[model samples]
Target: MVGLQSTEHAGDNCTPLSDERGSYTTAENGFKEKDATDTHEYDVYGDEDTAEIKYRTMVWWKAAALMLAETVSLGILSIPSAFSSLGMVAGCILVIGLGALATATGYVIGSFKLRYPHVHNMADAGEILAGPIGREVLGAAQVIFIVFLCGSHVLTGLIAFDTITEGASCSVVWAVVTAVVCFICTIPRTLNGISYMSVVSFISILAAIFITMITVGVNGHTGTVTASAHLTFAKGFLAVTDIIFAYAGHVAFFTFIAEMKKPEDFPKTLYTLQICDTTLYLIVGIVVYAFVGDTAVAPALGNTGQLVRKIAYGIALPTIIIAGVVNGHVCAKLVFVRIFRRNGMKSKHMNSHTFTGWATWIAICLAIWALAFVIAEVIPFFNDLLGVISAVFASWFTYGISGIFWLHLTPRSERWTTTKQKAKTIFWSLVVMMGALIMVAGLYASIVSIIDGYKSGGFPGPFSCVSRAL
Candidate 1:
């Protein structure tokens, strides 16, 4: 509130602040002037008037917990399987290195944006760099990404529940139970409330990891764990990119940043979050590999070894189910919010206590859930294609956007004059190119796999075969 002054007269385009307490319009420069007495008590995110308390409460633990929770969703289980496809040594190394590079890039971009308090989200950055088209494209991509992500999560939860209870007569009952529980846990929470759930999820995932490590350690490092002889460097690299999908939730960091009371503190917290995520990923990959080895590591542990694998599978299955549900609900809300607002409904207007809003929310959830069920039943290979598509889009949104940002924001005077800035530009350029290449390759691979599956009743090449085997 200390720095809460109007920038409307500063020549920046802005919208009026809307709230029940007070309304303040902004000028073209995105600044607004308001009387102290008429100033709204709530934060920009529409949370309660506890700025001082909230700012103090966002310690390192909360930030890390949020990051960990978001990172560990359905991606975790899929990561090991992805790695197994590329062979142990190559897969492990690629996952760690790519994750580190991608995460570092996110941190740099996030930090740069945080330095300018005016910038709120990726859309804001896009607008500053490229204009109206940038904002629209980025916003649409983000909203669509969130919707697909949520839908995928819902599908994963439903499928896993069905898989786990395959022979049981009560499988249908369990599926309904899962959907209800996810809705209860996810709906009707403020952004901060979701963060708390994220913290709990983080803890639950870590516990699962601990269980895995302990089981592997107790079992000793002897099994069918040899690397595949057919794995080439190219295949390994692609596998690394595929596995990188596991760490593709950097966009969710924006949601966290929005909730932060002290936006300035976000950079350090974001870095900490990435560090913790990368560390956990490396540790988990190593532990799982050490436990099962290369040859034995399959898509689902049920296909590998029986007793120990089943134990690991049991621990992982529940964690995935919970994480998937949460991810779906969060994603569902994001898409729902965007669709509603685009249609002229405000966030406050979408209260569950209101019949219209509540019905809308329920309708959206049921639609997504039903779609997931249909996809699960009809297309057995949908998950593989979903993972690839998600990765390609995520890479484009992150790498392409960052590269464009650097290109536009860098001053003409310093284009080739300053070594540091020039180097930064070159680095981002390469990142953009690599990301584009990966996107193309992933799409090609996914399409080919689908076609091959249709023609031959089996996966096409090694990666597809490995994906199916896993």
Candidate 2:
């Protein structure tokens, strides 16, 4: 907290750095405040000696754990299905290739955060690029993206329960139960606290997937394995977007860096995350696809025997709920910070436990969970939802926006000054174009898939009592 500053602004609008937004400098020990902004104190809990709540307590590993938990959860649930559609060769290629790109984009986000220490979230980053409009637009998009993500977790929870229970109870009831639990878990105000829970989340997912892989391998089901397949545009693209969604954790990278004890260590956190997720995705996608082939389903746990599937889903429960809790916490914190920023009490409420602050935080969490529940019930299809999210939001948050950030950070003259600079400029430009293409094509694929789902009665209608268990 010594060198850290609050990401909160003095007013509702995203303030410019010279006025309210200041910068950071690296010290021998770690990040030391160079020109601290009086507009907002970086420390949420004032007076470290007696403060009640603290936000900037995460070390690099803890942040890495949070990113791993957030990124690896439900996203991995669909990769085998992607492999089934795109084949083993293409699946492995996309997993590794997209992961490297995600790592690069995540690095850009860290550099952007270091450049503007006050920029805590996408909204703040947006302000740096385009003032109030960017802040509003990007901020809203971030919230929506996280909420939908949170809802996806809720949806996964419902699937787990139905799979475990063998559809003995209503899926709606399971959704309600999932939402309540996630809302309760999101009550704590600090990422540092959630970081510990993320450890359990990561372990839970590892165990579940390993169990799934072992069980499927033991069964030795024979199905066709193809290097590639012919498919329609919508089908092929949807599979691609599902893989894209697996790397969509970049949306929360800003918040992760903001909470880190040493913001400069973010590259370590980024690499840690990319390494863990990509390796897991490759192993899980390939092994599962090799065994189950065309018969594989999303949330690959469903590929095993009913008994083992139940066990895997039960084990996966923690990740399904906790990962969503992390997303809900980020979304709620955004609103909580905005509320305090508006009243000029951002520090007081954030620093210590106040009745008003606590109430607002709970209310925000409640609202977010409720909305997430509705979204879960409405969308109802797993692969389609992931496709839509990756296409619309992840395309920018994970890829496009970072390209913009790199372009904005580098001076035009400097971009062509050296061979390395020229190569980077060209690479980043291609990254931006790739993001745009994904967004446009992904939306189309998702829309078409959704319509096809309804037409084929592939899943029950929104809010239907039918079980969606894998």
Q: RMSD in angstroms, candidate 1?
A: 7.5
TM-score of each: 0.74, 0.91
lDDT of 1 at 164: 48
Which runs in model 2 stand beyond 4 Å of their true positions? 1-50, 342-345, 380-386
Residues 318-352 of candidate 1: C-alpha lDDT, one tens digit per residue:
45544544455545555555443321113443332
The collision pairs in model 2 are: 5-42, 6-41, 6-42, 44-351
RMSD of 2: 4.5
User: Which structure among the candidates has the greatest TM-score?
Assistant: 2
User: lDDT at 130 for candidate 1?
Assistant: 61
TM-score attained by model 2: 0.91
